[model samples]
Target: MAAASELRSDHALMLAVRDGELDALGELFERHHRPLFGFLYKLTSDRSAAEDITQVVFQRMLKYRHTYRDDGSFTAWMYHLARRCAADHFRRSSQAPHATDPAGLAEHADDRPHAGQHAASRDDHALLRTALSRLEHDDREVLLLARFQELSFAEVADILGCSVGAAKVRAHRALHALRDIYFRLQNPSRASSLE
Candidate 1:
C-alpha cells in the first residue's frame, strides 16, 4: 500500500483507479488530459470534438477499468482508449478528410520566421497543416503519435497494437506521403517529384 504522502507512479494510480479510487483517477486525468486533448484535436481538427473525445477517454477508462493491465504503461493505455474514442467520434460525424482546424494553418509556427526565410517558413507551416489534414487517417495517426505526441516507437506500437518495426515503417511511409502531398500542393505540376 502506497502511503498517502508518497508519490504514486502513474501505473499505480491507474491500478488504484481500476480498483475504484476516484482520486487516483483524477490524478491520472490531471496528468494526461491535455496531451490526450492535443493529440485528438490535431487528429480530428475540431476543438469541440476533441474536448468531447477527451472526456470520453476518461469515461471509457472508468467504464473499462478492469481491462487495464497493471504491468502495462498507463500512458499507452490512455492513448489506446483515446484513439478508439476518436474513431467512434469519426464514425458518428460527417467531417471531411480536410476538416479545417479552427486554429488555422500557421498556428504552430514561430511568431515571425526570419525575414529571408519568412515566405518559405509560412508556406511550410500552412502547407504542412493542409497536408496533414489531407492525410489518410492511419498515416495521420502515426504522425500525431510518433511525432507530435513525442511517444517512442515502442509506446506508439503499444497504442497502435503493432510491432515496433511496423510502426516505424508506417511512420516512414506517412512522412513520405505527407511530403508528397505538401509538394504536390505547392506545385500541382511537380506531383511527378514523388516518382
Candidate 2:
C-alpha cells in the first residue's frame, strides 16, 4: 500500500482546496513553495522580489482555486499562475531582470576538499548565470521551466500555452543558445569568430 502522503497527490490536495478545505492549501504550499521560490528567484534575480512573488503565487492559487481543473497537473497550473504573477511584477516595476550574484549561487554548491575545484565550480556557475540572464526572456523561461524545474515537456507546453512539440523545440533552441553563450563567456577571443 502507498503511504498516506504519497496517496494524496497534488491534484487531490488541490481538489480539496477547491472544495473549501482551506488547510489543504497549506499542504500544497508546503509541497511547492521552495521550488516555486527558486523559479521566481532565478527569474527575477532579486531575493526580495522573489520572496514577494512566491507569496503572491500561493495567494493567487487560493483565490483562483476554482479554476484549477482535475485534468491538469497541479504543478503546471501553479507554474502558469506563477508566470503570470512574474509578468505582472515586471509590468508594474518596468525593470529588466538581472543575474543573481555568484555568491548566492555558491550557497547551493556542495563543499569540496580542493579549493581549486570549488573555485572552478563557482566560476562555472557564475558564467552559467550570466549566460542565462543574457538569453531572451522567452528563451530563459523555457530553459528554466524545462530544465531547472524538471517539468515534462507536456507540462511546460501547458504552462507556456503551446503544443508539446513546440515546447520541445523551444527547449532545444534555448539550450543551444545557452551553450553558445556559456562557451563565449569562457572563451571571449573565440566568440567573434563563432559569430
Candidate 3:
C-alpha cells in the first residue's frame, strides 16, 4: 500500500489537473521528470530519444486526460504510458539492429585515478548503468520502474500488463541478473560500494 502522503500528493495534483489546472500537470512533471528521464536514459541508452519519448508520454497523457480516475494511482498510469512509449521506440529501432559490444561494457570497470571516493562513485554509477543496460528490455523496464521510479509491485505489474506476483518475481530475477553482471564485469570490490 502507498503511504498516505504519497497518495495525497499524487491524487491532489491529479484532481487539479483534471480540473483544467495546467500548473498541476507542471507540478507533476517537475516532481517526476528527473527520475522518469533518468529511467528512460538508462533503459534506451539514448538521451535525445528518451527526451522525445518523455514528451510523447506527457502529450499522450494530455490526450487521455478524461480517462484518468482518482481511484487509480497517477504513478501507475504514467508508468503504463512510459512502457508503451519505450516499446514503440524499441519496435522502430529493431529494424536497424546494431551489434552489442563489450567495449562500452568495459567502462563499468574503469575507475578514474583519483584520491577521494568520487572516482569510486563514478565507477559504481557506470557499473550500475552498464549492468542495467545489459538487462533485457522487460527486465530493465521492471527494475528501473521499481528502483528509480520507486513504484510498488502492483503498480509495476499494472504498467507492464503483468500480475503483481509476476512483477515481484521478475523484479527479483532482474535484481539477481544485475548483481551477476556487476560481479562478472569487475569483481566483488564494487559490490560493497553498491550498498
Candidate 4:
C-alpha cells in the first residue's frame, strides 16, 4: 500500500535535495506530485495552468535552496511556495477575460475518473473540486494542505503563516462548506442515490 511505503520525513529528503542529491528530488516528486497536482488542478480549475505553476514552484524551490532554514520543515516551505504560485496563477487568470478556456477546465477534470469500480459519485469529484474553489484562499489552503498534503495542523499553520487555532478553524469551515456544496450538487432531485 502507498501508506505502507517507507515514510521518510520531508525535512530529511530536502536536506538531501539541497546537497545535490538528484534521487532525493525524484523521491520527493514521486511522493507528492500526484496529490499536489490534484490540489492545484482543483484550485485553479485548469490543468495546463496547474501544471505550469507546479513546475515553477519546484524550480523556485531549487533556486531558493540557500534560503532554507533548518528550523522549519521543508514540506511546509514547499507548500507555502506552491500556495503562492497557485494564488498568483488564479489572480492573473481571473483578470483576463479569456484566461481559462473550457478546454483547460476539461483537462483538469481529467484528473478525476469519469466512472469507477467503487460506487462513489463520480460527479462528486468534480463537485468537490468546485466546492474547494469556492472557499476563501486561506480556508482552502489549510484544508488542502491537511487533506491532500497530509500535513499536521501545526505544519499547515506554518505553511499558511497562521496560528494552529486559525488553521483548525479554517479547516473546519472549509470542510463544512464542502459538505454543503457536495449535497447541493448531488441534490436528491438529480441523484436518486442521495435519498
Best by lDDT: 2
Model 1 scores what on Cα lDDT? 0.81
Backbone clash count for every predicted candidate, in the order shown:
0, 0, 0, 0
* lDDT by residue for model 1 (26-128), tens: 8788778877887887788777788899999999999999999968988888889998888888888855445575256344322344667766666677778
RMSD over all Cα atoms, model 3:
7.1
TM-score of every candidate: 0.79, 0.86, 0.77, 0.74
lDDT of 2 by residue, 1-195 (tens): 865645688999999889998888888888898889888878887778888999999999999999999798999999999999999999999987866555665443222345556778767877888788778888999999999999999999999999999999999999999998899879979756644
Model 3 lDDT per residue over 53-100, tens place: 888888877777778887888989988888788779889878321223
Q: What order do candidates take by lDDT, descending? A: 2, 1, 3, 4
Question: 72-170, model 4: which lDDT tens digit per residue?
Answer: 887788788888887787687674112233234555623555354355664455566655665666666667788877899998988878899988888
lDDT of each: 0.81, 0.86, 0.74, 0.70
Runs in model 2 with CA error above 4 Å? 1-7, 107-118, 188-195
Instruction: Give all candidate RMSDs, comma-separated.
Output: 4.7, 3.6, 7.1, 5.6
The order of the candidates by TM-score, greatest first, is: 2, 1, 3, 4
Candidate No. with top TM-score: 2
Better of 2 and 4 by lDDT: 2
Candidate 2's displacement at residue 142, Å, is 0.4
Candidate 1 backbone collisions, by pair: none
